[model samples]
Target: MTVPVRPDARRNATPYLYGREAAAVARVLESGQYGHSDVTEQFERRVANWLGVPEAVSVSSGTAALHAAFLAAGVGPGDEVVVPSMTFCATIQAILATGATPRFVDIDPDTLCVTGDLLMEAVTDATAAVAPVLFGGRAVDLSSVQGEFDRRGIVVVEDAAHAFGSRDGSRPVGAGGTALTCFSFGPIKNLTCGQGGMVIPRSPQEAERLRRLRLLGVVQSQNERADITTYHVDSFGLRYQLSSINAAIGLAQLDRFATTERVRRRLWRAYRQALAQVDGVTLVDVDVDRAVPHLCQVRVPRRDEVFAELRARGIGVGVHYPPNHRQPAFAAWRRSLPATERAGAEILSLPFHQHLTRDDIDHVASELERALKTTGGS
Candidate 1:
């Protein structure tokens, strides 16, 4: 098949850098105090202000953020965390890191997110927490069953790695002050910090707990530790602190978040409009009006064949995930999650990033339609 090349569509996802990122990193490099310095704290404060939250704790990675949140919430051995099977493996790994088993739940296939009803059905007496994956940057609202969770003393920790700038109703995802929301500033996420994460805690106490957890249980700041001969370890923790280098990149990215938000939404909508003309393709809704969408995905017939065909044509099509419940590593806790399994087989993530143009979206949609027809899907 002769397919016209689209260079922009050759990348599934790439960081969109504002001009200042290089200079920011240069400054951090020159400072020589890279490990969790004042710059890291500044980035946390800036993020909290942007999210309209009281505190945001910086971490080394999204997995570390999840691990810290699980530990801070008192989730441990003999406990179960309710989570969607459609999320990244890191979410499941984080649960296991806490010595807790994951009670895999199904998602609303259209949104690729676990609904309150699904989570409620999966919760048992052994359930210690519920970690909802905000797939494709769409916020998962668990408000309908909040009272039940409260009554049962079940903590809500959100794996909002894809939802950094998304909104739930009038407020941003982390600003709700309900769940312990985590955001990733990975290379391809809406905002790039090269690699870093943040946890938005519900209260000052939880914020302190997260801070301590990221810094290997140390109660003193780096400067304070330098002044004192000895530092105190208050609890069990990990070396998950976000370094000044990563924080510098994040701070620069944050300075241009409004542009990032606008560009991402526009790119997502372009894909939506173009994909509409392709038969047998169901665009997984991201609630784009309120979301700074992180991925443009679709449920297509013969997804594997379509994925292969797109790749052959140099279109950057990929799968968001294969259901975690079906993975061998998580076999012991796996259950029959019909919705998640079905979506796993059919979902395809298209090239999504700030770098793609409207023309790139059109080319991807056109090539997708052709691939579907060639695969006897349309």
Candidate 2:
């Protein structure tokens, strides 16, 4: 099979940059208004409108978005926030940063995302929030989960670190109907801003609170928009505001969203088609039609050996996550999560970037078959 190799396949997380990004940064530099100004605000608006949310507040990182969302929802020390064990450690760390305990729950083996049932089971009187991550861009069907959790007064926050341009049928992932949604614009995401995140709160009040919390707890009224303005400090906050420099890059990515999303979706579809015929591997359950996946992950036999083989063959493969429960930082919270363990032990991530071509997918599949039959592999 012909291999359409990436120019920079060695680095897995590098974002593709167009000249518009440089132009935006240059404009910011020329304006001399660098710290969270109109440019950054415009970027926030674009993302908010893109997600079909009323408002979105930008933060320094996706982790900060989670922390701000929890803090805005009144989560604090002693409160337990339920999340899946099969996510990036950022989810666990964000809860910890808010002085809340993270209760790691098992995921649905098919979707590789925590189910609402699992979250509900983990909840107790101390439970204040439940964040359902869109595992590998797989949309979480929160319809049933939200109503039940809402009755119990549990706050649901959708973590879309891997599902930026994704939609669930007709609705966008973070749109008005669902709970508050969070997105990461980290270098490897479907959309990247070098490093940034946002919170799509439900109401104007929630947006205001998030804005204040993100900007060192100051009043986020019109006064703060000026170059130098005095605002009353209401409470404690963190320096989690996204800078103009980062937003500029993100805006560039957003400008070309249609093209990028089409490419990403096409690449993923090619992987699904090719992998369907391969033995000893299967995709996690997801609505591929609506999913603009951030990675093309497949559960393969002898995952580690395959991972090594792909790396040796010059393919940038990764494990989306290693299950946060087993991490040393959450050692005390560690426990058996059967489905999560299954996913962690067998999952292999292949490159699924906007730059990938159908030939690359075929090359990867052809190479993967060879690796799966080697010694110590199934």
**Which is the leading candidate under lDDT?**
1
**266-337: candidate 2 lDDT, tens digit per residue:** 777888888887888888756778888787788987788889877876788899789999888999888789
- Which structure among the candidates has the greatest TM-score? 1
The stretch of ten residues in a row with the least summed lDDT in candidate 1 is 1-10
TM-scores for all predictions: 0.99, 0.94
Regions of model 1 farther than 4 Å from truth:
none
Clashing pairs in 1: none
- Candidate 2: give the clashing pairs: none
